[model samples]
Target: MTGRLWPRGLRARLLLTFVLVTVLGAAAAAWSSAGSASTALVTSTERRLTESIAGQIGAITPQLTYPPDQDALDRLRAAVGPDTLVTYRNLRSANGADTGLVTAALRAAVRTRKRLVAQRITAGGRPWLLVGIPIVITGPDGARTPSGIEVYAVRDLTGVDRQIDGLAWSAAGTAALALPPAVLLALLAARSVLRPVRELRDTARRLAAGDLAARSPPQGADELAELTVTINEMAESVQTSMATMRRLQADARRFAADVSHELRTPLSTLTAVVEVLATATAGMEADARESAQLAITETHRLVRLVEDLMEVSRFDAGTARLRREEVDVAGAVRDCLRARGWLDRVDLAAPEEVLLRLDRRRLDVIVANLVGNALRHGGPPVRVAVSASPEQVRIEVTDGGPGLPGDVVPRVFDRFYKADAARVRTPGSGLGLAIALENARLHGGDLTAGNARGGGARFVLRLPRNLEGA
Candidate 1:
């Protein structure tokens, strides 16, 4: 899990990233601009100080003795202005400034007499500009040399510092004002990008929920639009495939119903003929009677196959409506076994008061098919158990035979599936379990087949007590 300080949404993250970058850049530019303006003002102040100091020293050279007198020093200070500090040194020239602020480097530069020298120093929390000028005099032989007098001037720069501070504040204000517009622009950008993504997400959800025709509409002409177009194409392909599959499934079901309906007349004729043959062949030769009975048996099996197929078709067509009513679940199971003449062939464990609202006829079919399947393919003692829970009724049909193979258990309810594909002879048409499962589902129930723990096949049917469709 991420910390709450991390944004959980895309829009917030985008907006934050934009603002952070903008703020950092603005801060850097502001600092740079303030530093540049402050340096320029300091440079200009130093220039004015140097020029004023040099001119004062030139003017004071005429009044100075070998060691300058107090009067000459005072004239120099007056020339440099009272707000500035003027000092004469090297020969005990006069000034009120402390000598400690002057370094040996300034004195040496002044001794060279090549150029004026300046330095910056801080005193009492205020910046000061200091300039050094060497006093020179002309010799009678037309040669010039230092006269051994040095003048220094100091200027306070408290006002320049204030101006620089104001510039910094102005820059900060400009950046602060940019925030609202940056956030607004970021929101607009985030909305435009996420709109298409949101739409695509919704479309994908609908498609997953089985609305195959769902599509994402394209927006913009960038990569996002291309993505939308691709999604739509994929959806269209899936829709086409599903539609084709449904058509094939419908055609197959229609063919089964058509064929089953078409065979009814012929099946009726065959039934009448078989009954007559059964009566006529009883006293005939033994071999002939066996053949005749085999024929009758096969014809009966065919009739059952056709009927099961028709029932399955009705389910496929969704015409198998449930006729639900309040019915005793135990009594229904007992009656189903008794009607099939299997009362003595199976074990019954049921509670007498277990009741449910279900289609009794479908229930009967489900029970009979399960019992008959056990008798045909599984070993005894077959057990039919009827029970109930708070919200549902249950039926479990267990057989004592070796359980179905693991691979075949899940497919037992599939139409026309046989556990042994090579063994072609069985009393069943292979549709009994499929019909049973469909009938269970029509009553808002489900049937599942699996191996019982003690060893054998078990088929369980669970039905909601209050059925919805009747």
Candidate 2:
């Protein structure tokens, strides 16, 4: 039952759901952010590589002259760094020669008076960026003349790749740094959502346990607070209704006690007169004598009913007292069975010397009621058994009858709850089991009834064996 309450509850479900969603969302966000940052950093690195290559190629372009000048070519080659390449095409001979790394297409573009950027071209079994520049000389008429092209350069981007790797590591570090806070926030959010739901569950459990006044206090300005307020209102309504019911119950008990007390004296005098007439009716006609006997029996039943009601009222008013002492439970059960002349009719079993701290009179009442119930409604040959453990005493009454009806078993200990009609032939007040339950509770114990596995009804009473020790 406890497992069902927590695992099936809304608070636990919602907390789990929120935590899962937050963790997934945080992970997704981190992945997306890392991807975007990596892409932006890589693109920027590539752009810088392009710009650096272009700048170096442009700086050496103006220093080149036309008409196969070896001095200009040598100067260009010497001015360029080892990572840069210079290449020229001998258009007159349809031949290409170059210094450093240069592709055929770059040499061809220089010869054809076009500039080109050849990226990631293979050179000496390695990768390089080949930039081609065209040298244009102007005639006196401002016409363009193309001679040999010069100044092609290549820049190594190995350092750029290393910087990109560092940037990527940094981005990963940033993402890692963000996780702890996200986890903390997720935990807090889950707690905020679950706390009120937990309170509601606890309040609901207390209400089930008969504390109708239990309620949740509103906290924070959120939907959860509103839910708390709503639950509080519901608890208030329940508390009010329960208070009204208890007030009505108290009034009814008082009325029953007052009316019973008022009628007891008159009923006792009438009972005496009826008894005297019952003696004289022995000589009268058979029908008249039977009627008189029925009247006496009914009067006795009425007296017993009034007395039971008074006792119930006393318990209700908190005026019932127990003369507590250490006594043998087996002796009490035996005495009850012997006094009621039920020792021969029913099977009475007891442990030899099961001692308990209890009121002997109340114990007798408890045993008598359970035994009488078994004998009356529980077919015949009922069994009363007593057993004791280190902590508690257990008394069980089993009947071989049809057992209690399923629908009526739960309310059997309620006052005025008769399995049959109240005006029927049964010689018992329905308050017997109710009084027995009350007495058991007053002794800090409980009495419970259920169907036995072997097709009968069983009433089990449990009481603390040593109240003082407890």
Candidate 3:
């Protein structure tokens, strides 16, 4: 419950904490002051009342006869005032209404100690002080001896309580007055502390969103300012690093594209020469024919590598464009399989026709790569299933073989990634899955690789049904 009510933002929490500390401090101070003042007032009032009663009794005692009668007691009580009570051998003053204020404990203490004692108590919801004093006579040797006559007086403490109450109210008022100032200070502090934090937060957000140049201005010379400076330095370092990385990537892509272009002409001439050699190998010796076929095979692989590299460069340079056309997806998959002479080896599951707006050539490329990879690396019973929804088209190609290794699934679409590092001379150039994924992404779709429930490697290619709309 407390967590739910607590402020979530840094600024609000800071402000609330500041105000709470200030208010609590003020309340504590006020309470302490009021308590101290109340204690002092009560102590001083008790002392003054005890002394006044003692002085009055001392003055009238000299005139009274020792072991006096009722007359002496009446004179003593009248001298001490109406709230005073005098007793001599069970002779209490007739006007003894205030006698009830003194408890038996006070009377016993006064008689036993033979001196003055006072007690403050509450009666009828009003404060009262009961003072008990035993009169003493001076002997010739200057020694004081107790007189049988004991004096008791009751003092109303209502006025003193009122003053103490006033003091408490004043303290409360002072505490109340501290509030506005505390709130104002809290706001100022919150602004000073949270300004840099808010700026830093915004700058970090911009940096995360790819605005590498984003920075927060340093404010005061404090820890937060130092942090701001550090963050700015870090952002600058990151910006420099990113620029260097981008330049290197661009140069690498350019180099690949340039080399591919340079090799195209020579490769084309070599391909033609290899074709002539292939035709002449029929009459050559067996050893020569085998070597010629080997040369032809490697040359074709080299040509394909160069082409795939060129395609990757086009993608990296953002030069690839889509030629969207209404294509029969099922027909395109079937045609790709037929062209590759894989029609007899693979299984096809599709509706009669599933039409989509897509690039025909890219679609064919995607299917051909997936199917070819399955045929080369996977077992027999390769299956190509096509399905369509309003939003996209899905094509799943699975092979009846061991599923992809755990570590290989994540990098399956990465260029030049091979599952077995030692098997380097596979028919694939290692760019087929990568290129297929790129083509799928170009159509605002995606390609994913995983294991099928039936225990084979699964490659799913999802393409948006309407590229123009996408």
**Which candidate has the highest TM-score of all?**
3
Candidate 2 residues lying further than 4 Å off, grouped into runs, are 1-154, 165-232, 324-328, 351-357, 389-391, 405-409, 419-425, 467-470
Instruction: State the displacement of the C-alpha of residue 306, model 2, in Å, after optimal TM-score superposition.
Output: 0.9
CA lDDT of each candidate?
0.82, 0.76, 0.91
The collision pairs in model 2 are 85-154
Query: What digit string (tens of lDDT, one per residue) describes model 3 on residues 99-186?
Result: 7787999999999999898888998999999999988889999998887888888889999999999998988888888889989999
lDDT of 3: 0.91
lDDT of 1: 0.82
TM-score of each: 0.67, 0.68, 0.88
lDDT of 2: 0.76
> Compared with the true structure, what per-residue lDDT tens digits does model 1 show for residues 195-254?
898999999999999999898879779999999999999999999999999999989999
TM-score of model number 3: 0.88
Candidate with the larger TM-score of 2 and 3? 3
TM-score ranking, best first: 3, 2, 1
Clashing pairs in 1: none
In candidate 2, where is summed lDDT lowest over 10 consecutive residues? 90-99
> What is the number of backbone collisions in each predicted candidate, taken in the order shown?
0, 1, 0
